[model samples]
Target: MKTLQIVFIALMTIFTLNAEATEYHVSVNGNDNNKGTAAEPFKTISAAAKIARAGDIITVHDGIYRERVNPIYGGANHLNRIVYQAAPGEKVTIKGSEIITNWKKEKGSVWKVVIPNSFFKAYNPYSDVLMGDWFNKKGMDHHTGEVFINGKSLYEKSNLNDVIESKPYEEALDQEASTHTWYSEVDANNTTIYANFQKFNPNKELVEINARESCFYPDQPGINYITVRGFTMNQAATQWSAPTAEQVGLIGTHWSKGWIIENNIVSNSKSVGITLGKDRSTGHNVWMYNPKKGGATHYNEVVFKALQIGWSKEIIGSHIVRNNVIFDCEQAGIVGSLGGIFSEISNNHIYDIWTKRIFRGAEIAGLKFHAPIDMLIKNNQIHNTGRGIWLDWMTQGTRVTGNLIYDNTTDDIHVEVNHGPYLVDNNIFLSELAIRDWSQGGAYAHNLIAGKIEVRHSTGRNTAYFLPHSTKVAGVSEIYCGDNRFFNNIFIKDENGEESEQEKENQSYGLHGYKIAKYANISSGNSYLNGAKPQEGETNFVEKTNLKPTIKITKKDHHVFLEMDLDPSIFNVSTSIITTELLGATFISEAVFENPDGTPYVLDTDFLGNERDKNKPSPGPFENLKKGLTLYNVGK
Candidate 1:
């Protein structure tokens, strides 16, 4: 029995050693020498992260940690996947901690310090009171007027600005504000404060003021499927002397893929909030940069590009962008894609974007795809932007449907490319606006296109202005108006009785050869006007051309059928062509002409021979064509 007991004890000891788990605890007041247990924890999160393995959790206790910690694992390919979670109800703050070594005092009705030219290249002039007001409005703490020079209070000196202006190394720190109050000015002499604030001290470090590095890094590669969550990134000051691209915060490059940045507060950056590269050719990827870019800069020029994707390459497959709130960015709130394929961007709220010029209002485009293919943009609310949604530069085969666009300064939805099989349907453009260069081969069917439909060439020259050229051009080569179809739509005019007749004429400007059928149900109150008084309760039929060709039915069978061989030249005739063959009683339900491989044949000028002269109508073989006729239908 005693020998059995000894064997059992040895087995139990080996099992315990093999199955044991390790936990690392970090506390603000704990020492680094401690064992990192629940009762005795490490002092810093960085220390714990250094020793943590793949399946480790580092629990942080509640307190303000003023140290800037780079929690990147050298061994692990993914940097942010390592979670740094805090205990419940314990708020851990990571911010810049500036310890004042000396102080100085200055006397003035308006507390001012003249920074010497030797310290910085330029200076920003704004009173502390003004800054206080801005901070209060933004829900930040305020500062007072007492000046300190390196933690020691300064004596009230006469002409203090002059002293600082002459001295390069001189530092003036404000002590009139609370001990915790810290602010730095942008001037020559304040370079010391700037350097001092940014100084990194591992021993008793202050919170990191610049959290820009926490967002993203461009140089890294193969960083796919990583998520960074639950953190606040403070703004980093911009180096105005440097180029715009070099300005700080979360920059990405071509190789970056499958990254998800969510539930983070980013503010007060010099340039854009988040910047994405032009890497569209990278397939099967999903990347998102969301929420705020935190902090305040001296330049009112501060703007946020909350999310930027694809300025260079085409991104494809399983891309999703939704539910992000972006505001008060300088250039554009969200700028996406000059061109790409198979991408979906929807349900993002963008507002308060400002630009420098008058014609350039707060430009916020819901989805700006230049020459995109096979894309779908639906169910987004875009309002109060300079141009709500713009599709420029040969956008093809894309669908902009089911989005609610209102209160935009310019056209709600603008499509510039003229070569496309794109579909713009089921979208609500609350304002009656103009869509330019819509002569592309596609269907604008089942949509409430309430605004004035204006069609023009590239130079803003209305298609109506080219009437003389329309006559001279042979055979309506690319019937700018015809090849497309618009059916089952509603057009509403301005209810305020303000639009003019010429404007209305401009609205319904280009309707030469386009087929607008089944529009009899269009409401009378929805007036169509140009640059004239609002035509009240006027309903106009879309004039159909006599050149529309009809398909005749001939015979039908179970698996084989036949129809009249209608040549393409039949389109040039000015009268609707109709033929009644032997009524085979086998009625033709629907007849459509398709290419050999099954795509619908597009009828353009190439398909139709040529346009007849305006003075003389083109002669047709009406009497000769009546000789032989055939119509057939083949089905399963």
Candidate 2:
């Protein structure tokens, strides 16, 4: 009775503390000196953030906030998290850019603006060149500074003459928009920007220039349990967010934990959009500073060093990044290294990543992570990216499930240099190159794969793999290739699909790409259509070379649909529901494909969250997919 009374008293204390939590208000027509209330609000979000404590809420009204919100303190735990949100049914935009109207006319359609160097304070983005370990500048200079005219970003030219000429570049995605170019000349005293606005006058339009590095990011590490929601955050001068460097985004966590960044539109970053990455203390571009070792060697060294300095589930990760629309970023939409471990990234629409072909890099994707151990990447629609989901190194116990991935210039998924016990299930891959499997020990099940696969071995770089559902490194092993399980998947090839002659010749569809690998794959109960071949010594697969099903992706009114004609007899193959016990253990990591909490996963749900048959399951992502031409709403 005494123990029960003590527990009740503790619960009552928590309830009382939560009940007395403060709610601060911020508005554009307010003063910093005023008391933060609904009647008398704070002028800036930074003002309210300076005073907000645990379990407090900062409600920002509808306006354009042009300052970077650096929260002074973080909540103690998830239950008492400090939330920074836009007012309900309000349109709030937080930008890293400042409006500029002092543009003098130059020759032709070009204009020039000279700003004092004191305006940039400590960091001048125009002078800061994009350089990192894996970042390739394509033999051209690319600055983090950007020029926006009426909410549209202009392409950066290498020289001022290019802005004066105003000719469209041949390789640009938007050829006409390429003519709208900007060039910067940075001196010790001032920074001059020359831009070709075409017909639009920069002084008359809503012209803005990149002034800040990040819009909403904590300056320090250990700022945990913060939530940012319902804001349109954009136009940051984020740098090249390679894994070896400090990855600052438009709104980043900066090696923090329990940050919930959701229900916001993140766009127009010079590099990455959202970052859940490591700090510089662990190791920052050590390989770039001294090129004595390869990138893999430097990364492997950093992993052990991070472990020594407390890299675990309790300290880092467990972030929730969901329901966000991220786009127009030159690099990754969501990127992290070791700091993304045990995180959940779902229901996000990430696209247009690396769309600007001005630069190339080893790390360019919709979502890229180096050591995403025990992470959950589910139900996200990633399209029109360089690569869809790129998971490199130490991908143990990770699950990439129910994602609708398509139209990627590179492969839909690239798993590189990790002996994973990871799970890829119930996904729709409609790109030309579906899975680029450089690493091994993954379980691919119940997926609708409509493209070619590139399976190769990684013998040179020996990457680390962790214990099941944990960050502890069990062993380090080179990928000999193919300790993988491919079960109940549908591989389709468009024989009459729109392709150039060279593209058709280069296409090697389905599991045939795994033939040249050193190791062998465990393949069974898969359906191959239109010249997609099965693995060698596989007797349980189905082939339909004569049957041609019309398959294509359609987008209308911001909704994505998979228009496909599947025969009803496609479900004739006998397949069992996959489970952790049946998958057993991976060869290198000895980790079973399980949940983050080390529980066995039952693959009983389809891509649309429909219940699968327990006895004999269907061989694709959809359980009750109709016959003939059916338009399935895949974006939901």
Candidate 3:
């Protein structure tokens, strides 16, 4: 009778809390002083966020909100969480930039603007130079500030003279827009900017500049179970998101868990777009401050330090970042370190990342993560970035599946220094270099590799690997290079004489690069075409020298299509369904390739969610794919 009474009281309390939950509204035409109702809404999102409790809803109506929304509180749990969403069929843009109209003509195509330092209050992004561990300034200074004209971002110049006498940058992807540059000078009293607007008049046109560090991010950590949905968040002056530092993005979940960021257009961040990363207390730019110790050593120490201070699954990670369009970021489209463990990143279109090529670093990519233990990255279309997906450090039990990647300047996927039981399956790798394998113990299945694969041993640096589906460090070991299993993959070589001189010199095309590997490797049922080579000591393989399949990606309206000329006879090769039992375990980590929840993964479905043949599965991402110039509508 006593136990039943206790349970009843708990149930009643939950019901009361749900009954009392309120819905607050925010609109541009509304006043903060009014009651946050549909008729009288709040003026800013920050106002509603302050008083919102668990199970509360904050609905923002259509309009541009030009302020940082710092949520003071998070929900108690995932069941009863705080939701900040745009009104249905309405467009709401949250920005870290403010419109600037004051301008003076400095030269024929140059315009100048001077503003009081009081306008920025405490934090001025113009003076905040981008710096962190593993970030190379490239002998030039770059700030976290930006100048925009009519929503188009202008390139940053180092000096006022460069802005005045602007010339097209030879290395820029779009050289014509490079001439429109901006340079800033900040002092104790005022901030001044000189910009080469070219033909546009700054006073007459819509001009904006970076005013804040982040658009929507909590100042402190432990803000958990918050949902940010259906808002166009852009143009934030975010800083460099290094693995050793507190990564602040345009919209970030700083060291938190259970955040669902979906259905929004995120773009034009000064550095990173979305960050689900660590906080400053664990270790902030320790490598930059202490160079005597190597980066790998520092990161290992940081991991232990993080574990000591609540880095478990209960407190950090498990973020859901899906169905968002992210582009035009300099550093990474999505970045995280240890705090990205057990998260799901899916169906996001990330492109045009690091295209400016102004600053070089080891951390630039479409999606970059460190210590992503049991993370699921699936169905994302990443292209035209520096690297497609960079899974660095302790990438244990992670799965990369159903992703369409192409046109990346660097490799499609770079698995660096990880003794992994990680799995890469059903992926389309279309780049000059598909895989840059610096670590070991990976399984690649049903992938269409149309580029060279570079394999190397990280003998000098030893990296950590964790227990299965957990953050507990199991062991640390230097990479022996090839404890990898490759099965049912399609390898193709470019028949056209378009190979770079360096690629020809290295001879990195196909599995031939794995010849010099130090450890054990396996390859079976892999098909090679158009002079692509097979690995040494492999028996089960297919080859076609005369078949040259031309693969290209074409965009029509909002849809992206993969146009490829494939022969249906290629499916005649024998292949079986991949499973955890066949994958075995990594030598160092002793972890098996399984799902994030420790469930067995049977590769029974194709990339398009079609069931594979039970007896003999087809190779590549598709099952029984058609021949002769077929087009696959890869959703953007």
Which one wins by TM-score: 1 or 3? 3
10 residues in a row with least lDDT, candidate 2: 498-507
Clashes of each: 68, 0, 0
The TM-score, computed over Cα atoms with residue i paired to residue i, of candidate 3 is: 0.97
How far in Å is the alpha carbon of 165 misplaced in model 2?
2.1
Which stretches in model 3 have alpha-carbon errors above 4 Å?
1-14, 497-507
- lDDT value, residue 77 of candidate 3: 79
Model 1 Cα lDDT, one tens digit per residue, 288-310:
11113211111111111211332
Ranking by lDDT: 3, 2, 1
Rank order (by TM-score, best first): 3, 2, 1
The better candidate by lDDT, 1 or 3, is 3
Listed per candidate, the RMSD to the true structure in angstroms reads 21.3, 2.1, 1.7
Candidate 2 regions off by >4 Å? 1-13, 496-507
Worst 10 residues of 1 by lDDT: 464-473
